[model samples]
Target: MTTHPAPTVHDVRHEETGEGQPTTGLDAFAVCALSGAYSAVAEARRFTAAILEGWGVCAPVVSDAVLVVSELTGNALRHAAPRGPDAAESRPDLVCAAWLALAHQEAGVLCAVSDSSRAVPALAAPDLMAEEGRGLWIIDRLSESWGWTRPDHTGKTVWAQLPVPRPTR
Candidate 1:
């Protein structure tokens, strides 16, 4: 068996400010295999939770935010596999990457997932009979608003905004 190089974090950017102030943001990125690995998902969730917590997010909202990351990561893993096993082994440089951005906007936290896949995500039709195909739909219902941005033909970033909880007097 061959060994795969561990993923590395790159291009991390962050910003923060007081509540009722201008938008602040935090972003983390990693490059890893498209295989269905628990470690990859766990790391992504942990990183996301950390960023949200650092930005003074509540526990419940942070949990939900992590779920969004999981969904997006799962989608990337399912769709963005390398050409073949040998191709992956011979050239690890083509590995798929996951980019998570948590931005504090006037309305809420904008969570964005960027991947090295060209395919765009869509909400599947409601199907009580089906067991799968509802990730985007669930994201839409949970988030205030969501969309995708394709800066180039090679990749796209899907983002969703979760409203901040109103403070109690």
Candidate 2:
């Protein structure tokens, strides 16, 4: 008997936002695979850098945005694993299908991470000495406002808006 290797996710795509769309001023969008141990964080950095560069956002803000994406994507991978190994292999497909939207809101640049999982992220208290459980906490502190939205509950999108820095005099 032969066992087939599970499928992996790849080939991310990007699209520009349309005028008057529900998500306005969306400069760039991307979707990447969430498979393997580090795919999410890698993709988050890649997408964040691309979007930030395209928008001409400065280095510091871009760095912070990438960090936020890393945390959010990491949480998704850690918590939303598939049932079996084969199932896990197929998870990359789901992750690749996950969407990211970068929009300009009154508050600042909005980074939205959307996934097929309906699970909502919670901010849990972590031991000060602990090495984990601070992803959302960091996000909360850095973002002006962060929250999740589920239009029909089939999936949810978590978002954070970072204020645009003022030009240095």
TM-score of each: 0.68, 0.71
- Candidate 2's displacement at residue 130, Å, is 1.5
What global local distance difference test value does model 2 have?
0.67
Cα deviation in Å at residue 54, candidate 1?
Answer: 2.5
Residue by residue across 16-121, what tens digits does model 1's lDDT show?
4566554334343323233335466677778778877887778888888888777776666566544444746744655445556667655677677666667777
Model 2: which ten-residue window has the lowest total lDDT? 1-10
Q: Per-residue error at 89 for model 1, in Å?
A: 7.0
Q: What is the lDDT of residue 21 in candidate 2?
A: 37
Over 38-81, each residue of candidate 2 has an lDDT whose tens digit, in order, gives 66579778978887878788788888888888887777666654
The ten-residue window of minimal lDDT in model 1 covers 1-10
Q: Top lDDT: which candidate number?
A: 2
